[model samples]
Target: MKRRTFDKLVSFVGLGLAALLLIFAGLLNFGANFANDSVASQLENQNISFPAEDAMPSETKDQLAKWAGMKVVTGEMARDYSDLYIWEHMKGSAIAVMGKPATYSEVSGVYMGLVRGGSTDVEKIKQYGDLRQTLFMGNTLRGMLLEAYAFGTLGVIAGYAAIASLVGGVLFLLLGIAGLMHIRRTPEDATI
Candidate 1:
């Protein structure tokens, strides 16, 4: 085959792979949004409180500021069958954040404005909201926590896809180049 013909074929394959990546990335984003919506709806039907800006209180806000300042440990905590991993898992990312951790205090108590996780046990959550109403009683931090959690989820997914795509995309691009080189060195009459 001629060099131009070979180049065109390589270009076609490259464009096809790029198109597929575009579709894959779109689907992943769509799925994430859908999941977030469904979980939110379910929580609402259950009458669970979602944290919001208005739900926050001065005391809880201060506590959150403190928690943010504390040395955050990013290691996995024993929760259930698999340990609940810390918010960030990027190489050294969690550790660095922990190095300057968010602050909290047993004294400042609870405040509203925190979002709840669908996966978190409802009962355990109530303990924080209902039972401890006397100690700390506001809805502010809950929403803030939930929002932070959602962002963490997004970061993990995007980071993994980015890393994997870089590896695969580079490998495929190299393979396409190698195929072109092979065709160039071969005689015109030789079969591919």
Candidate 2:
């Protein structure tokens, strides 16, 4: 009701919201770092490489074609291959497979396709399928490394947000304290 009280309330609310944002940012950053560390540890435990020869076994290619059934491969199918075919075949230090080195951004784009729906182009599906297979299977360690990089990037963004939120929180808290300190009893002088 009083101007001083209203100012105090507003300031406190602002400070509280700022504090929450700061906390959220911290959690996000921590999560990102944790993800990165986990990936790093996994990568460090193994060696990864892309096969010089990018050849798909005829049987495997046939199976993929059968699965395709004249229609484009669905995201679900891609994931299935990643989980089943790729995961099963993945072994030893070699982790042999086909295809060139794919950038993280390219892999991310393919992943986005999986999240969205699927592609109709047979070649795109095959390329992405191979990409996912190699990334998830043969080069699992490298894949983890890529994932860690992504998480680290996210952490950097979160860190920036955390710093901003912390600054805002401190400012709001200081303003609230100042408002309370400067409050006057007289109605005319009560407004902060």
Candidate 3:
């Protein structure tokens, strides 16, 4: 093939790649926006909020102080509430029952043992049962909040990816255009 024709082929291929990248950038941007909007709207509807700074203890105050008294909206806020608030509350509830931080499974095990042994200590058995119930509810809510955090994190990652894609698309588009311009300047008789 002629050198000019070869240059044209390579140039067109580069242009094609640039076009694809640009399209991908657009799609990624759309996806990022949708995910962010959906996450924000869902969290807003839930109306969860951080505790007031005054209500927070000294130990947790510094970490949570920034968002104190604010409604949970972002992934970071969801994570703070789920891990710091819900997890701490669950641990405290467990400690009250078992004298230490314990898992729901452990409390349920004790409750089941009490039933199986036909123990007459109704109060002790009831304590375990109540703790298990409370733990179950806390775990459920914590799981949901963590899921929201994960979804929101995905949105955040997608937003970054979209920006990267846009930059890459622009770079490749310039490169492709430069390649076409180079082909114009390239002589017909040039062989490489």
Best by lDDT: 3
Stretches of candidate 2 off by over 4 Å are 47-144, 184-192
lDDT of 1 by residue, 77-139 (tens): 011001111221221232232343222332223213222334355554553444334222222
What would the per-residue lDDT of candidate 2 be over residues 37-111, giving only the tens digit for each residue? Answer: 654454445432222222323335544444432221222333334433444354211133224445434665775
Model 2 residue 130 CA deviation (Å) reads: 15
Worst 10 residues of 2 by lDDT: 47-56
lDDT of 3 by residue, 125-169 (tens): 999999999989888888888888898888888888888877877
Candidate of highest TM-score: 3
CA RMSD for every model? Answer: 14.8, 15.5, 1.6
Candidate 3: TM-score? 0.92
- Can you give the TM-score per candidate against the true fold? 0.37, 0.44, 0.92
Q: Write the number of the candidate with greater TM-score, choosing between 2 and 3.
A: 3
lDDT computed for candidate 1: 0.42
